[model samples]
Target chain A: MILPGDLSKIRSLEEVFLIRFRLDKKSKVPLLLVVFGVMLILFAILNIVLGSVRISLHDLVRVLLRQGENAVYDKVVWDIRLPRTLAAILGGAALAVSGLLLQIFFRNPIVDPYVLGVSSGATLIVAILMLTGVVLEMGTIPPYLLSVGAFAGALAVVILIVAVSGRVKQVVTLLVIGLMIGYVCGAGTTILEALAEKENLHNFVLWTMGSFSGFGWEQVSVLAVAGGVLLVIAYLLCKPLNALLLGEDYARSMGVNIKSLRVVLVLIASTLTALVTAFAGPVAFIGLAAPHIARLTLGTSDNRALIPATILLGAVITNFCDLLARILFAPVELPISAISSLIGAPIVIVLLMKRRTSL
Target chain B: MNVMQTKELSVGYDGRTVVADINLEALKGQFICLLGPNGSGKSTILRCLAGLLAPLHGSVFLKDNLLYQMDPGDLSRTMAVVLTERLSPGLITVFEITAMGRYPYTDFFGHLSREDEEKTWEALRLVGARDLAERYFNELSDGERQKVLIARALVQEPEVIILDEPTTYLDVKHRLEVMEILRELSRKKGITVILSLHEIDIALKSCEIVLLVKNGKILASGPPEEILSEEMVAEVYGIESAHFSSCLGGIEMSNSGGAQVFVLAGAGSGAPVYRLLNKYGFSIITGVIHENDIDYYVGRALGGAVVGEQPFEEISLSNIDQAASLGRQAEYIVDAGYPIGSLNRRNVELARRLMAQDKVIYSLRSRQEFEALYGVDGNKPVYCPNLGALAQRLSRRKK
Candidate 1:
C-alpha cells in the first residue's frame, strides 16, 4: 500500500521531464544545437563571402537580398557561390544523415555509405557515363541523367546488400561484403578510366576526387527537395531506429517490423548518398565522420536528437571545409575531399581514442 | 484464463523442425519455467511463442486471437520479451531504455506521456532499480542490467512476459532476487511469467509449473512437485552420477570407489558430514536418522547408505542392528554429536556398543562430553571439535 508521503513523493511531470532529460545532461543538447545553428549560419555566410574573388558581406547580402547589386558580384554570388554553398550544405547534411542511418542499420559505428560501396556504385555508373562517352555519343547529355544513373547504381548495391543482410546475420560478414562490393565498383571505375580519352580522363578524375564547386541552381533545387523529403522520412523513423539500437530481436519484440525497417533504412541511406555523390562527386569523410561528431557533441544515441544534430553538424562542417578548400590554395582550388579528410580524420581519431568503449 | 496457448506447434528454422508437436498453455498469473540442458530447443520454443519466429506447423493463440494474425503492436501490448542478448546501446540511460517499452502506447515520435512516465517509474520501482534510472545502461553490472531489462519489460504492462535465461549471468543473490521479483509480478500483477531456464533448483522452488524440454520435445509438463522426480530429472538431463533430490530440491554428485565411513548421526547432524565425505571421495553410511530429518534427505541425495527409522519414532533395535552391521563393513565410524533426546536416547547406546566392539569412532565432542553422553568410563572415541578438525583427522588417516 502506498502511503500519503509516497504519493506526494511520486514525481510531477515537470520533475520527471527534468530527471529524464538530465540523465544525459541533455539540457546541453539545446544549448549545443543553438551554438551549432549560429555556426551553420556563420559558415554559410562565410562560404558566400570568401570565394576566390572575395566578395564583401555587404555585397553578398545585397546580392542575396537582390538590392544594390554590382553585375560581377551578382553574377558570381548568384550563379556560382550561392548554389555551390547551398549544395555543400545539403550534400553534407544528406551524407551525414545517410551515414547515421546506415550505422544504425548495420549496428556498427564506423559504417557509412562510402564504406558500404554505395558511393562507389554511384561513382562507377557516373564514370561509365563520363569516360565511356556512352551518353555523350547520344548527342546531348540529359541534365538529370547522371543523377538517375547514380540513383540506380546506388539502389542496386543497397538492394543486394539488403538481400544479403537477410541471409547473413553477422554484422562483420555484412561489412566485409560491403567492402568487397566497394572494391569491385572501384575496379570497374579504374578500368573505365584506363580506357577513356585524355580530356575525358581529367574530368572523370576530378569527379572521382570529389568537389562542391560548379553546382547549378537546378541541381541545388533537386538536392534540396529530395534530401529534405528523405531527411523528414528519416526523422519519422526515429522511434523504430531507437528501438533498433537494442538489436533486431528487441526491436521486433517491441512491435517494430524489422524486414520493412531494414529495407527503408537502406533505401534512405543509399538514396541520400547517391543524391549527394551525383552532384558533389562522392565526397568523403563527411558521411563517415559527421554522425560521430553529432553523437559525441550531443552525448546521446536517441535518434530523435541525433538525426537533427547530425544534419546541422554535417552542414556546418561541410560548409566550413568547403570554405577552406576555396581559400586554402587560393586560385588552385583543392578538392573538398582533401580538406574534409584533413579535418574529419583528426576529429574521428580523437573521438575513437576518447570513446574506446563506444562510438 | 489462458493468456496463451500453442496447438501442435512445430518451431524451427528454415522449415527444419526443432521442437515439434508442442501443446502448451500459459494461464494468467502462472509462473512457468522451461527446464532443460543446453541446446534443448527451449529458446526455439520461446521464440515461436513470442512470435519472433514463425511456427513450422500449427498455430499459436493469444487469448482468443491467432498469434500470427494479430498486429505487431497489438501483440506487443499484450506480451513482452527479455532476451539473452547483452545490449550495449551507447549512451542510453536506464530510464530511456525502460521507457522504450512504451512504444506500443506512445505516439509516432515516441514521446512519453505523463502516464507513460508514471508507468516507467513504477516499473523501475518494481524491479528495485529506481535509483539506477539515471545511470547509463552500459555502465551497469550484469545483475543491474538484468533488473533494468526486467523493468523495461514491466513498463510494457504486458499480460505475459517471456524471458530466455534471464538469470543465467546473475550471482546467487541476484538470481534469487530476480526470481522473487518475477514471482511477485506474477502473483501481485497477474502477469503470466514464462521463461526458459537452466537452473533446475530455482525452477523447482519457484515455478508453479515446469516443462522438461529435451531433444526437440517437452518430455513432461506439470506442477514441478508432480513431475520433477529424481529418475525423471536424471533421464531428461541424461545425468548418470548426479541425483536430484525432491526433498532437498537440489542435485548432489555421487562419487564411486571411495573409502567407506559409517556415520552415526541424526536430527540434521549428518548432512554436512555426508557432503564432506562425498567431496573427499569417501562413501558414506549414515544411520538411525528419522525419515523426516533433513539429514535423511541430504544423505540419500549424496548416495549415502542411510539406515533410517520412522518419523517421530524411537530408534528401533532392528534399525540399530542394521546400522551396526553396515558400520562393521566401514573402515571408520563418525559419531555426529546429536543431543540425546527421549525419542533418540538409543543412539548413545549404539555409539557405546560400536566403541566396545573395537570400532574407531570419530566424535565431534570432547572426551568428557562423549563419556557423559554415552555413560562409559574406560572405552573412548577419538574426539574432534568441529567438522574442520574431523576432516583433517580423516585426511590424515587416508594419508
Candidate 2:
C-alpha cells in the first residue's frame, strides 16, 4: 500500500498547505522558523527600498557596504526610515497578538486588540491635552507625554471593562458596553476638540491620524522591550487561553485561575496595545486583524504556531501597508489605519460570510 | 476515598437557592446519571461539583480535598466539565481543541510541551477521533463534536468528568454513541463520569447509579433497577408508565397513549375536517403515508396504522404494516375538515361509506384546533369533550 509513486504524487497547493500545517511537532520546525527569519530580512530590505525617495537595490546595497558616494541617501535610509519601519513591525505585531488574545478571551471574533479600550482611552487623554492647551517647550508635541497619557487611560478602561464584562457573561453584551465606552470617550474627545483653540485643535487632530514616522530610537526601544516581554508572557499562557476558549467553566474545571488569568492576560494585552497605540496613535486593525489572518492561514490557535505566524504576518503586512500609505496619496501621505482597514474589513467580512454559509 | 463528596450543598442564582441537598458520597469510577425534568437544578448541581459554581451553604469535596479551598488550577487538574455552551467562533482545529485540556500543566504562555502533545494524542485516540485531528472543530458533526468535547476533557486527565445533558439535540443514534463514550471512559479509564440526560431508558441502560433530582431535593439515588421504578418515574414525570422486563434482564417501559393521530391524511384542506374531533379520549390514527414524510414517524410513535409502502431507503419505516392495518379498520371516518385532493380514494371512500352507513359526518371549518381531541368521530362517547356535546345543546337533545 505504501507505494513510491504515491509519495511522488504532486500535491495541489491546498493539499501542500494542509500537509505542512499538520506537522506542528515536526523536525523541520527550524526550516519553518527560517522561513519567517527570511521574512524579517526581506522586511528590512523593503523598508530601505520603498520610501518617499525610492532607492534602487543596487544603490541601497552599495550605501550599506560603504562603497557608494550617496552619504545623503544613507542618512535618509538608516537614520530616518529604518527605525520607523522597525517600529511599525514591532507595533503591528504587538497590537495583533494582543487583539488575538482578547478575542479568544471574550469568545467574540469581533473583539479587537483595543478591547482593553487603549485607543479610546488614549484618545481621551489626548483630547484632554488638546482642551488644556498643554504645550511643552518643544515645537513638536513630546511623544513621551502622549505615551504616558495613553497608558494611564488604557489601564483605567481595561480594569472597568473587565469588571463589567466578567459579570455580564455574554460576549455580545460586553462588546456593546466596550463600544459604548469607546463612544463615550470619543464623545468626550469630540467635545474637547470643539472647545480647544486653533493650535491645540491642530495638534489633537494630527495625533489622532496616527503616524509611525514619529517614533524615534528611544520610543521604539521602550515599545520593543515592553511588547517583547508581554508577547512572551502571552505565549506562556497559550494553554490557559486555549482552555478559556472552551468557556469560563471549562477553564475553571481545568484548574486555570479564570479570574486571575483573565486579569493578568488583560493587563498584558492592555500593555501591548497601550504601548503601540501611545506611540503610533492607535494603528487600528494591526492588533484586530493580523491575528485572524495568521489563525486562518495556519488553521490552528495553538500559540506555538499562531504567535510566530502572527508576528511574521503582522510585520510583513504592516511594512507593506506603510509602503502603500506613503505612496498612495503622493504629496500627502495617508494614515497607516486606512491601508489596514481597506484590507482588514474585506478579510473579516469574508471570514464572517464563510462561517455563516458553512453553518 | 470517594472520588466526589458533597456536604449539605445548596446551589443558587445570586440569593435564591435552586439545588438544596443534604450529603452524599459518590463511589469512585461509577457512571452516574442525574435525571430530572427541565429546570430542576440538575445543571446547577453539576456545576457545583465541577467547581464552576461554589455551594452557598455546604462544602464540596473532590477526592477528599475541600473544593473551594483548592486552587482553580488544581481543581481543573482533578475535574473536567462539559456544559451545553456554543464555542467561540474561531479557526481552531480539533488537535488544538483537545490540547486545551493540558492548560493546567503548561506555563502561562500556552505552548504544549512534549508531554502535553502526547497526552492530547492519547486522549484523541481514546475517543476514536484521531483522524479528525486536522479538521476544524466547528466542521465536525454533532456526534463528532460530542466526542471531541469528551476528548478535550479526557486530556485534562481528571479524576472526574461532569457533563450536563450532553444528549440534547442529538438524534437517538448520536445520543447512544455519546453515552457509550462516557461508559467507556468510566469503565476503562477509571474516571468517575457524571452526566445528566432526558433520555430515561438510555440513562438506565448506561449508568450504574441513577440520581433523580426533583422539586429542590434529591428524589432517589441507587442502582438503576432499585431506583427507576414505575411509580417513581410516574411520580417524577406525571405520565402513565408501564415497566416490562426483556428476557435478557433488560427493563423496557411499555407504551402510554398519546395525542398523535395518523390520518392516512390527504392533500388540500380535507385533513382538517376530522381534526375537529377534539376529545382527549377519542384517539387519532395514521394510515398509508408516503415514505420520507414527517408525519410517518409521528404516526408510528403514536401507535398508528398504515397500509402502503413506507419508503425504506430515504426515510425510516417503523411498523408501517401495523399503522396501515389500523387505518384499514378506521370506522366512523371524518373528512378532517377539508376538501379532498388527488389522494388515495380509500380514505375518501371510507368517509363516504361511513356517512352512507348513518355514521354522523359533521362539516368543520378548519378542524386543526379540534384534532387536539383526536381526528375521529365527535358523536361517540370518548373520554373528553367534542363539538357533538355543544351541538346537542343547540338541538335541545341533552338526554
Per TM-score, the best of the predicted structures is 1
| The 10-residue segment with the lowest total lDDT in model 2 chain B | B244-253
* Cα lDDT listed for each candidate: 0.87, 0.70
Scoring only the second chain, what is candidate 1's TM-score? Answer: 0.96
Best by DockQ: 1
Chain B TM-score, candidates in order:
0.96, 0.63
> What iRMS does model 2 reach?
3.0
lDDT of 2 by residue, B1-399 (tens): 588888988987786899797366777788988888889889988888878777889999888889889877788888888788766536667888888888778765666799999999998988789988977787778778888889999988888999988998788788887888889888888899988988778777888888888888888988878887756776666554333221112223333443333343533232222223222322456444454443333333333343444354321233343544454444434433433334443444443323344333333433454343335443532221335543343234213
lDDT of 1 by residue, A175-244 (tens): 8988999999999999998888898788777777788885899999999999999999999999999999
Alpha-carbon shift of residue A71 in model 1 (angstroms): 3.8
Worst ten in a row by lDDT for model 1 chain B: B372-381
Worst 10-residue lDDT window for candidate 2 chain A reads A350-359
Candidate achieving the largest lDDT: 1
lDDT of 2 at B84: 83
